[model samples]
Target: MASITGSSISSSFKLNQALNRVCCLKTPSISFKGISLSSSRLNQATRRLSITCAAKPETVNKVCDIVKKQLALSADTAVCGESKFAALGADSLDTVEIVMGLEEEFGISVEEDSAQNIATVQDAADLIEDLISKNA
Candidate 1:
């Protein structure tokens, strides 16, 4: 009977440790029966969790660079977030090649529908961020 109780305590401790690792971002306490476990310790093990992948500044810059390189645009030309590929003289073939370049650079496959929707530099950056987060 004593050994069984000891084993149960050990298992509970292990379970609490695992929970702490998963829920370390939030300071939430979980209660099991009458025992409470707090995951607010600064020294506890934690895993990073990214819920959303929004377009970051660096992603926008990289996308702009890719677009400029793919289209062979002049260095004097500016590619802003709202700058549409079509406005930048990108034809259907150019657009396809640009999408392929993005895929190769980011190591993520872009769906046909999603590829068609990428009009502006911001759109490509946002899609790339989402794909990267999903892959992560």
Candidate 2:
């Protein structure tokens, strides 16, 4: 679990950035908590829920940065732990490239099954940490 404190502003900013990435994909709508949210409504929801991160913030940050770079996202585009690769416009080939970048950056080799399961930035970060500890 991640803590919510004085960094709420930063957290919210990252969340909004991530949400914006998804919105740019032109999704018609998404349902969460039994509520169907249009693009505009999802933006509102993002502002309300940006106080937590499930993994180490540093690891998450690195993953987010790598993803953004791999996808050629603009500087203003924010990538957060919850940001999914598919939502960021990464296809199968792009995903493979992202995994390669991560392997080089983290000095860890992700097994085929593990790589297949990394659908989100958080997923990649979590796997990196797990591999790091196991190797150490």
Candidate 3:
């Protein structure tokens, strides 16, 4: 009877530990999704991620720089050219990298199908702006 009691107590303690561990794991995830970071903090992070917005004239140039570096493309040609990524000779693998790079830089995930529709640099910037506002 004493051995049985000891086993029961040990099992209860293990169960409690398991529950506590689950709670600890879930707590931060719940808080992170529920809490929205302040704009100043977000903007600072965005700046660190290489997001830059200049006046209209420099806008395209900056966007091109971001796309070129992020996509590992030639700096000589403009990214604003009227060419879809698929039309620009990018394969499925290259397109995935491009999308991932954009998401990392913008702090948002561009849906796979929607990414296929992006034709110009402004399209990407617009989507990032929308996603940032929504996430905020």
On TM-score, the candidate that comes out on top is: 2
Question: Relative to the true structure, how large is the alpha-carbon lDDT of every model?
Answer: 0.71, 0.74, 0.51
Which run of 10 residues does model 1 get worst, by summed lDDT? 42-51
lDDT by residue for model 3 (10-96), tens: 755543333322321212111122343344553454344344432242444555566677567775543542224543456777766
Task: Tell me the spans in candidate 3 whose CA falls farther than 4 Å from its real position.
Answer: 1-63, 81-83
Tens digit per residue, CA lDDT, model 2, 1-136: 1222236576565544445456434343544334455766665555444444345779988988999889998897757767788767899999999999999999999898999999988789889988998899
Ordering by lDDT: 2, 1, 3
Q: Which numbered prediction scores highest in lDDT against the true structure?
A: 2
Residue-wise C-alpha lDDT for candidate 1, range 48-67, written one tens digit per residue: 22223357868878888999
Q: Which residue pairs clash in candidate 3?
A: none
TM-score head-to-head 2 vs 3, winner: 2
> Candidate 2 has which clashing residue pairs, if any?
none
User: Least lDDT summed over 10 consecutive residues: which range in candidate 2?
Assistant: 24-33
Candidate 3, after superposition: displacement of residue 101 in Å?
Answer: 0.4
